[model samples]
Structures are given as structure tokens and as C-alpha cells.
Target: MILTRFKKGDLFVAVVTATLLLAAGAAALIARAGAGDPVAIVIVDGAAVDIINLRDARAEERVYASALGTCAVAFEPGRVRIAAADCPDQVCVHTGWISRPGQSAVCVPGRVAVVVRGDRAEVDAIVG
Candidate 1:
């Protein structure tokens, strides 16, 4: 069998590697869980039009008019999504709901972007 080709030391190394990967994944999940509530930021034409805290947001839809067309954003208690858009490509709507921090849905043709951000001050990007 293929498994017989590996030595005892190889099996030990594989087990250790798997254990470390699991531990790292668990740590990442724990950190995200404790990072505080997440908020969704709606940007139109490179300007923030709305910032809704997902924890306290109501179930509703907000529509905005953009340069290319209009778009609708739906907000739930702990998630947000782009429901509809008039752009040619419906990529944003296809993205579905996003409840985690750092998730985003963008309508390039409509010039609209919805980004989810956590309360924790994590460096989103470095521009140099």
C-alpha cells in the first residue's frame, strides 16, 4: 500500500504538522469570535454613505443611486448583502450574504461597495 512507503519518522512529522495546523486554525477562529461586533460600510463614488452596525441593524433594504445605475443593499441582524443592481454584471448580488469581518461585495459598474469591518483595529491594508 502507499501508506507502507512512509517511515515512522515520516508519520510523526505528518502528525505534528497536522496538529500545528489545527491549533493555528483554532486560534484564528477564537480571535475572530472575540474581535467584537462587525459593521457594514456602504461606499458610493469612493465616499462612505452609510455605516451600519450589524449587531444592532434592522432587517431592511437600502437603495442608492450611482453613476452607472442603482443598487439595493439588504441588511439583517448579523449580515449584509447586495440584493439587486442595475449593472450589467450581477457579481455583487451573486456574492450572497456576508456576516464576517473583512468580507465585501462590490458593484464595479455601479461604483458601489459594501465592506464588513470589525470593531477591532486590524490593519486592513498597507499603502506605501
Candidate 2:
């Protein structure tokens, strides 16, 4: 019975669904295109400190930053991580490495943060 009624309403519904799916796919592609590439951004005390190009960084680098005390940032290839921190919890240091957009390690006590972003880059965690 239901299969027999697919002449008008069902066709409209199917067309609408296909259109919606196509629109969604196109929107996703546009967003990805606008995002460009992932970059490492370091923020300290609500300020950006460094913008690093992980793609261009062949040699591993250790970045030392001092805010409340001290923290070490390291990166290689396409990933960034917090190597160590003098803060009490050391949570930031345990975040390991991040390579994808939106991945981040934040130390509230030290006011330090490291994040991988899809566009642009910034640095942070420098007191002086």
C-alpha cells in the first residue's frame, strides 16, 4: 500500500532529501577549503606568543617560556606538545602531541596554552 503512493509526495520528499544532502556536502567542503592548513598556536596569559608552521618545521625545536614560572614547548613534523611545566598539576605536559585542528593543551595555573588550528597561528606564555 505505501509503496504504491510514491508518485507525487514521495518524489518531492526524495528530491528535497537529495538537495539537502548535496547542500550539506558542499557546505562541508567550503568550510574545509576556507580552513586551509593546520598551524600551531601558542597562547600565554590571554596573549598569543608564537605562530609555528609545523609543516615547515623539519628539525625538532624546544621553546622555553616563562610566565608564572616556566614551561617548555616542543614540536616536530606536524605536531606540537607541551614537554614540561613547573606548575603543580603538570597536566599540560601530559597532553602529549597534537597534530589536528582544535587539539590543545592548556595550563590554567601558568596561563599557558598550545593549540592546533586550521588557519592562522599565534604564540603565547611569555611573561617578559
Write down the TM-score of every candidate: 0.67, 0.62
lDDT of 1 by residue, 1-128 (tens): 86879899999999999999999999988877755788899999889999988989999999988877799999999999999999998999999999888888999999999999885736574355
Best by TM-score: 1
Compute the lDDT of residue 24 as modeled in candidate 1: 100
Candidate 1 vs. true structure, TM-score: 0.67
Tens-digit per-residue lDDT, 1-128, candidate 2: 97876688789999999999999999988877745567788898778888886776565656556557577888888888888888899999888988877788888788888888765334332234
lDDT of 2 at 103: 82
Would you list the C-alpha lDDT of every candidate in the order shown? 0.90, 0.78
Question: Where does the lowest 10-residue lDDT sum fall in candidate 2?
Answer: 119-128
Kindly report which residue pairs in candidate 2 clash with one another: 42-123, 42-124, 43-124, 44-124, 44-125, 48-123, 49-123, 49-124, 50-122, 50-123
| C-alpha RMSD values across all candidates | 9.6, 7.8
Q: Say which candidate scores most in lDDT.
A: 1
Residue 82 CA error for candidate 1 (Å)? 0.4
Which ranges in model 2 have alpha carbons more than 4 Å from their true place?
Answer: 1-35, 120-128
